[model samples]
Target: MEKTNNKHPKGLPYLFFTEMWERFGYYLILGIFVLYMIDPKDTGGLGFLDKTADDIFGTFIALTYLTPFLGGFLADRVLGYVKAIYIGGVLMAAGYIGVGLFQEMPLFYASLGLVILGNGFFKPSISTLLGNLYSEEPYKANKDAGYNIFYMGINIGALVCNFVAAYMRNKYGWGPAFITAGVGMLVGLVIFSVGMKHIRSANILKPAQEGDTKLSTVLLKVFVPAIVAGLIGWIIPGNIFGSDSTDAFIFACIPVVFFYVNLYIRANAEDKRPIGALLAIFAVSLMFWAVFKQNGTALTRWANYYTDRTAPAVLEKPLETLYLVEEKSYESKEVPIYDDQYRAEKNEAGETVKQEGKDIYFRNVTPERKAELEADPTKPVYLFNTELFQSVNPFWVIALTPVVVGFFMMLRRRGKEPSTPSKIVLGLFISALSCLVMVGAVWAGGNGLEKVSSWWLIAAYGVITVGELCLSPMGLSLVSKLSPPRLTALMMGGFFLSTSIGNKLSGVLASLWYGYEDKANFFWVNFGLLLLATGLGLSILKGLNKVMKEKGVQ
Candidate 1:
């Protein structure tokens, strides 16, 4: 045990800063991504339907996570971790910049592709490199705490980015906001390069071990099949999963999932149990992410349209000074309202088409509020930026991480620390309750007919934040602890694969929001899925714990 609570390696600080800045850029773009997509094209947005935006968002995030598999594999055998990190950083920066400079659909998708590929290379490599640093003595004893600290750095970026996003998008436009994301990414790359010497020792590439799965075999078996499966999904008769994108994504995941399963099946005897434990934990954890990842989708919706955004004048002016307020002017001119697809039924020639209406947000506002707005065309309403709410979950993470880490350290000192498996189980249960908190928010809002207090969103994020602290960092620590030395990065990729699946699933669920008139039921379904995962996690605890003990990980 870390009796003296020794200082972490110098490299830890460098990794922390690199990850912090990278996430700053990432979350900044993500905070406004769907909003930008669904916003009117004339207003500097993509002009996609809400469902379409959700699908793209889900696919983007999922693919971003999915690329880590290739990244990790290449890092282990071809490119060293540091080289991979640098490449990934540059690509992501360029991708962010591309999105800002281009407005065409093809260009927009290409930018997203750049991000996905870049994230694959960057994410797992840096994480594995961090674990490598902790693998040495003294730091080994504090691996979990180190991961918690590293995780805190991620939230720091996440917390700050939304404020920047809100300000940029509010003051300038969509392009400037996206450009800022690219700038942040470049800054991150600079920091990582500057700190290269400190992390150099941990970037050593591992040669293939006897009986290891060769890259050639994996390409033929997994990559080729995944591409074929995606094609099959795209060409299938109708929408089996509500959309072609969703169908393709799910189908593509099959081979990847099977690849992971194949890992366990092919493992040598000594590695089998730990691999099994990881797989099982990965399965249950998918539910946590399915619900948690909604911060970018369904929760964003609530913040945008349902929650009360009007700030008191005193607070409003100060917030505006900080560029944290979005001001909307009331105009006297009447515009055709848009249908669900955001199309007007009548053409300029007065031809028949889809129905149209005012902006959905204004249409949903109370009649009294509408009249008050209509009374003064020149008046501006200062509302808290919806993206500002994205910071809440990360804020909670920063606030609670220290407490969670300290609590566990105290437990360890008393020889009473709960095993990682136990912590994960508790996290699953706590996460389920966060869904219920949102259910209450829907109830308080009277099924979205009226605006509700902002505290409802805050409370839900707060509850879920606690669950996240227990789960996410621990999962990283678990992989670091349990992975076979040579397979560490690959296994980390597997963990992210599970995350990719959950992110896609989150998108699927969020896309269904418009279909649910009773919003509470949507949250209730989220609650039930989490509860189910929690139960499954509980059932597997004994076995997972046993494996951890066998591996001497806890």
Candidate 2:
């Protein structure tokens, strides 16, 4: 047996801070995005409708996670992990700053493109670097725990960034919040640059395996074909899908998807099973992502519209002083002030929609709250900004990570813990229940005709977070465990591919937000999707757990 330290490595701290700040910035931008868009142009947002926001939101995330495929491959082949990190970090900072500084619609779109491209370079490479660092003989035993800790760093950023984003968006407006995010990224870059010495050893790039195609070969055979095919998909005469952007993204994924197919086809028999299993997991998890990704889109809307977001008088002053709360006046008739920057077209009812001049934020708000604000003559009514809802998932992740990890450890000691696959199956099942919470929230809120308590959203997230803790960290650990040593980098790419696809589907699902008039029906739809994914996962759990046990890991 190898006599290694078997504890997590010194580099874990650096990686932790690196990811913490990186996600801090990334999630900050995301948390405030919808609010910024739907806010009145007079208030500094683009003021788009919910459908438009949903479309762009879906596409933005779709690209953000999708690019990791390109990023992972580039690192595995041409650019080493450190260089990829540097490139990605710089580009992302530039993109964040670009959005903050530019108010023009074209510029905003361009800025999004930069962020998308930059993330492809940034996300997967850093994760791959962490994996590489752990693969060193001395640290191999601790890789799973190390990855979980690293995942915690991501959630910490996610949890805290919302407050930072809320404060900036409410107090200084959207630009400042975005600029703050950009600054966070720059600080992350500086830290990573300073700690270059620590990670230098793990920066080693492996030579292509004997049967593996050369970098040039992949570029020629995969990259070029993808570009050509994607271009064709983009300019096709009519929209086969709902939006041109969706068409373009799907087209773009064709070559990338094909590349993975080739990898599986070409892989040795031993490698194939794990790759096949991962690919299968990735395929099924698309539904999970589609539902889970709604945290930002549909769920955010639920918080903004259906939830009673008023801060009580006792807590209001402190929050306002901290700039965590924003004040909107009913006297000013600040009916969300949805206009050109935030307008949506209405049907015969004159409701604000994604039609162009309407802010979708008003869609789910209980009519009672609306009437109360419209009729109030007393002190100005204050509503909590919608961005605050973004904190729930990460907050849950941070609060639950240690407990979940410890419980598993305790179970391991007693030989009663579930296998990683079983845990994931459990995770899927638990996550399914979160939707039920929302279904109840819908009814509780009187079918979205009245504002419900924020507790509904809180309770739902709390449920899903446990599932997330079980599934998400464990998925990363599973990849490290099952992937063959030689093809680890490529296989990690596969794992992210699953995530990327799921992320895209999440956007696709969100785009349908405008279609569902009854919000509870919308939530139930999400629930059903997760239920299907969960059932599929459990169906395979017997086999997956068998394989995991054979791998001789907990």
Candidate 3:
């Protein structure tokens, strides 16, 4: 055990800044992405008619998550974590900046590809590096605390970016915001380069196990086949699964998922059980992310188009007079008030079209305001930017972290603190409850025709942040606790793989944004999904508790 007062690795500071800036860049991009895509075609956005935007959003994030499998494998067997991080950072910066300069589809796709590939290289390796730092004798005792600290740094970067995004978008426009993301990444890369000396000890590449695929062989076997299969899937004749893109992505992911399963099977005896359990946890965790990540896509859509974000007259005067907030005309002209069910579009044959007026926000905005905004041409409505609400979750993360850490420490003193698995289960259930609050918001708004107060979003975020505080940090802690000493870094990648999947699935869920007619039904779906995942976790709780006991972690 580490001495009671031993400090964390000297490398942590370097990793912390590097990660913080990287996330700053990423969140900045994510914060504005959908907004940019869906903005008016006249103003340089894709103007992808809502459904198309959702599909692209889902596909991009999913592929973004899916690439880490290759990234992790290569780092474990070929390039050390440090080199991988550098390569990833550079690629991401280039990609982010490149996106800002182009409105055309080809450049857009290329930039996204760059970001995905960069993340594959950068995301998993850094976490592995940090895991390596804490695995040693002097810092062992403080591993969980160290990770919490690192996670906080991530939140710090995430929280601050929205403000930067807001200021850039509000003052300059969308391009600056994209360019800003790239610059943030570049800053992170510079920080990492400066700190290389402190982290070299933690950057060692592992020797492959006897059955492990050679790096070159994996490229030939897994990647080449995946590419060929994906090409065919993309080129297939019919829309087998709604879209050719979706079909291709699913096909591509199949081989990667199977490869991971094979890894668990091929693992040495000591590693097998832990791998199984991690994979299990990863499965449940996907549900959490699918719901949690909506804060950006669906939830942001709600904040933008539905929620009563109007600033009070008194508050509005200073803000507008100070030139900090924008006041846009709100005749609710975005959609017609007369169409029953607020349907925005219809087919000429009098057939009811499915895609019209399905913007996620319309479910929450009431009929009265729709008419009012449409009728009143004189009143200029000053509302807070919808992207601003994106900060709420991370804001709570910063506020609640100390309290959560304190609460757990109290339980530890009483010999009643929960195991990591138990905390995760509890977190999932609490998360379900957060969605129920949105259900209440639906009820209060009279099933979403009426605009509700901002408190609904506020309360939902508050509740979910509690769940996030419990589950997210603990997942990282569990990885550190359970990983075999020999495979610590590889397993850290595995942990992030779960996060990557969940993150992508979040996009998938968000992409389905136009599918739900009633806002309440949409939230209810989220509620049910969380409850389902929670029940699964609870069922396995006893076994997980046993595993933790075996691992000798509290």
Candidate 4:
């Protein structure tokens, strides 16, 4: 209810920058995580097989999202949002630094555990705090625009961090690059501390109501059962979901899923409809993330091995000067031999087999380049860093945010703006089309027999980024609008619960990349999944709109 002429709250800019720096760190790590995992051990990587790496990547992201369930609960019931954010930020910083310093698997996993735990504490609290800030006055009507602006801040960080990660990794090696993530996180924490005065009023903690579940009971009922089920899933005789981790994750999710369902079942009459609507939206949106989150896994694989990464002649020298290009020489040495699909050849013992040959990058090169490379074997080919492609989605987000916001504003002025749920459904439909772009990429590249232009990847990311803009931030705003005041953060956790499952599924889908003989089919599957999600959203659109109208929110 504080008035300001800035058209937004005083706290918005502070939260925006705080989240920007935090995402800078998170996205930086994500941009390079899979590449690091699959790189050879000699290069200071885990040297995991692509499938194994995909599994770990999926599980790691899944756990990070999953922990928000407890984090939100604790923030709502015990710790205030500000304290939780500080704790989370420090822990994440330590984790990033630890990852840089350690190489042993156990230590590395421990470091990731720190990040997972830290993100749980950090992620939900910040968004919830921002929502609380918009709970009153003229600000209330502007929640969607506020979240859109905040989302742009997130992408600004995302867009720039990949370049920094590329420069750091290319110049200083993986350790320093990982360590830089920690530095970024610390910087974010510093910003948060500086802006604490501006935002502290928004960090209100609601007192428990009579029917509210106690934290102790939740721990006993939800956490304990989830752990037990996960353990059982892990130790089962045979794999049910293609891997122990997958099985464990799916099994663990059962209890948590049931808990959310139970929350709906037990909700008071007034709270039930809105909670139900949020849950419905959560279920449908999971498919969108299942496809979109693949930018880190399957899509990165396309950029790394399938796309033509040759720097344009005009910019090659400048890129090289900046250390933004990765150079591979045509040296005939004992390196991993890849098949047409770019899978490393493995011996019967499951170890990669190497033979004296040109690098895998040459496998799908044009005939002219192949002859030229063979004639001058010592020549190095300078190409853009594969991780640089990770920036494309964020770049699209930043470039398009203003357009999207303006378009919606125009519609709002004309009394024709779609509700948030409608936008989300439209997003799913558009995101499904991004898969078609990749399918075209597969066709254009002649089914992996040749390298495709990088433009294909860029265009695909462009389309998906549009869908992401419509859905992701809107989901956050929708939660703020519909949630019962005390349960806002908890419902936000439910949104992320959908994201966790989708992330894990993204990994599962990526792991199957090698199994697809015709890569177009892979993208087609993604398209089908999104279509299903879009249809589901449409089916429930009326009911969801009704709930929104009843709640007196758009």
TM-score of each: 0.90, 0.88, 0.85, 0.93
Residue-by-residue lDDT tens digits, candidate 1, 1-554? 22234668778888998999899989988899988877766567766777878888988898888888887788878998999998999899989988988988799889988988999889888888998888777778887678778888898999999989888887888898988988888888887778777778888777667857677876888878999999999999999998998999899989988988998998999999999999998998888888899999999988888887877878877788787576566653445455542233344333323333343456556667888878885776788888899999989888887788799899999999999989988998898898888888888767867777899999999898888878987887799899898677668778888899999999999999987878899999999998999899888899999999898788
Q: Pick the candidate with the highest lDDT.
A: 4
Candidate 2 per-residue lDDT, tens place, 1-554, comes to 12336476556678788889989989998887866766546556676666667777877887787678667778878899899988998888888988998978898989888888888988887877787788767778777778778888898899889888878877776788898888888888887877777677778787777866466765687668867877887899888777777777778778878887887898887777777677667666667777788888778877776688888878777787775665544343324334322234444433333322222334455666567655764545555777778888888887887898899889989989888878887888889899999989988867766668999999999998898888877777788888777666556666666776677667678767666667677778888888888888888877776666666766
Q: In candidate 3, how many clashes are counted?
A: 5
- Higher-ranked by lDDT: 1 or 4: 4
- Best-to-worst order by lDDT is 4, 1, 3, 2
Give the whole-model CA lDDT for all candidates, comma-separated: 0.83, 0.76, 0.77, 0.89
Residue by residue across 343-432, what tens digits does model 3's lDDT show? 333333222234323233434546675576668745676667777787788888989889888999999999999989999999999999
Global local distance difference test of model 4: 0.89
| Candidates 3 and 4 compared by lDDT, better number | 4
Candidate with the larger lDDT of 2 and 3? 3
Candidate 2 accuracy as lDDT: 0.76
Clashes of each: 6, 15, 5, 0
Candidate 3 ranges with C-alpha deviation above 4 Å = 1-11, 131-140, 196-202, 207-213, 216-221, 263-272, 314-324, 330-379, 483-494
